[model samples]
Target: MTPPANAPTFLAQHGWEGAEIQPLAGDASFRRYFRVLSEGRRAVLMDAPPPHEDPRPFVAVAEWLAQAGLSAPRILARDLERGLLLLDDLGDSRLRETLDIAPEREIELYEIAVDLLVHLHRQPPMSGLRPHGLDQWLDEVSLFPDWYCPAVGLDVDGAGFRDAWTAVLRPVANDGRAPVTVLRDFHAENIMLVDGRAGVEHFGLLDFQDAVAGHAAYDLASVLEDARRDVTPSVERAMLKRYKEAAGEGERFEAAYWALAAQRNTRILGVFTRLWKRDNKPHYTNFQPRMWGLLERNLAHPALGPVRDWFDRHLSAEHRAAAWAQAA
Candidate 1:
């Protein structure tokens, strides 16, 4: 994937003339990133081509998060018509890679992440974002039956799947906790460990364009029960306790956490499979077992009885993680 045709013109117009452009990364979406080295300055160029991609939401959320005192990337320049953006480079030290290299920093780093959520929840959610509640949850989990089941040779009951999810998630949607800004993709891989920044600022947020006004526990569950990496049971427990204590949440939060974790993991199971089958990104299959592990743990919660029972009857262990073992 080369940079957009007019990326140089876009960069030059923004004073990044003749900068060295190097491919950085492309995420699950159509967006591609490039590192720009101009003179002594460094920046990241976002190529979010039109029709299939848009930069407006990203710009809106990034600006909103910055205004709310979070470390979202600064938008230096943008050409929304062409779906291009030049942003302050948040650097290369991702929390996921950092943890892989230094597992010892797990507790310390995760605490800071939890604290950032604690602080974020204290603020009013950004206005005009989509609501993520029972309806959204039901729709998201539908991906499992719609994609995953068919991919693995199971013709599971779609109605039963939706009903089971509705039973478990309806309460969560009405849990009465105030909504917070949910960085929908909050996870280790999307976090940057910035240098010279202390406290929560050390964690530069990314991939948050799809943020919505949603349950506070949603993002907590997202980070603690990460889909891409293993978070030790003890560490997960510690962080859950830390968030509950800091956020003044109790039993309801715990229940919501598990329920939402299962919802997220289930959705990701289908999503990763879709990425493989429909999108031709076969590498995502490698995360299926990990997703199954996380989902099974979430299903173990007593409150998720209906959802768990649905899975138990429909998907056997061999059809669950074992089905993906070879792919992993």
Candidate 2:
């Protein structure tokens, strides 16, 4: 697509000039980005809908990250009203695309990612970036009945799962809490490898607009418990072990890790459902097994026994159908 005549005008007003433009490969979300290759300067241009994908959160998070000295993409220009963002080019070096590299190299690069997560998690709280908190979590978890119920086509049940979720969270929410920035999507796909070597310190981070003050283990789960790609158990274990050594497990680390993981995984399930029923894209339904894995993992946690019991009864049909339907 040719750059709009007004597009150059917008860039020129912002002190960017004379650039050759090409579209950068996009991700699963509604946002799209392009590479603006200029004279000895390259930038990424992001296009997002105002209602669905605002750049305000992304802008705030990027500024905070820059101040903290992280290797994230810097914002070059933005049209907040239009939700268009111009960013530094981090290159086409996603960890997901290059994962076939040797295991040793993979582990090395992952360690660097862990280090970055540690840095963000260690930062002090800033307003407007915290988790949607208990209220949002409650609402989010409640959606299970709305979507998972229909998908499974199961006999009706009361709000038993919600009661269990609250009962389990009451003590943890009261007793232990640590706050820090959490990049909700910190998987390999968003990371840019600088050095060809795996596990090196040189890398650029991207897609951190959703950063929020959250539990310390949230981003770690984002990396280790990745959705789009797989992280071998051995590697995930190593990454967690490294995080534990570096940060010293915060209060109820494992509990929080699994809790936030459940939250994240549920949010993804709803998103996938919306993608199919509302957005007309059904490929996301292919992630049925992975979504079930997340649900089961949360269930297996001892504290989540009540939640697990409900899922065991309700999710069985959905699980079986999801598997067999996709296979067919």
State each candidate's clash count: 0, 3
Q: Model 1, 1-328: lDDT tens per residue? A: 6877899999999898899899999978999999999889999999999899989999999999888888999999989999999999999999999999999999999999999999899999999999999999999999999988888789988998899999999999988888899998999999999998988898999999899999998999999988878998999999999999998889989999999999999999999888988898878888887898898899999999999999989988778964365455
- Please identify model 1 stretches exceeding 4 Å from their true place: 322-328
Q: Write the per-residue lDDT of candidate 2 for residues 1-328, one digit (tens) a residue.
A: 3443456766777777767778676667778877887778888888776687888888887777777767667787888887778887778777877776655577877888888777766778656875746666667766656665555455446477677777766655555566677777788788888654333336677788877676677688888877777677688778888888898874377776777777667667766666666676677777766776766666677867766776677666555346325423
Q: In model 1, how large is the Cα lDDT of residue 320?
A: 90
Candidate 2 lDDT for residue 63: 79
Q: Per-candidate TM vs. native?
A: 0.98, 0.87
User: Which parts of model 2 have CA positions greater than 4 angstroms off?
Assistant: 1-6, 14-18, 27-29, 155-158, 195-201, 317-328
Best-fitting candidate, scored by lDDT: 1
* Per-prediction CA RMSD (Å): 1.0, 3.0
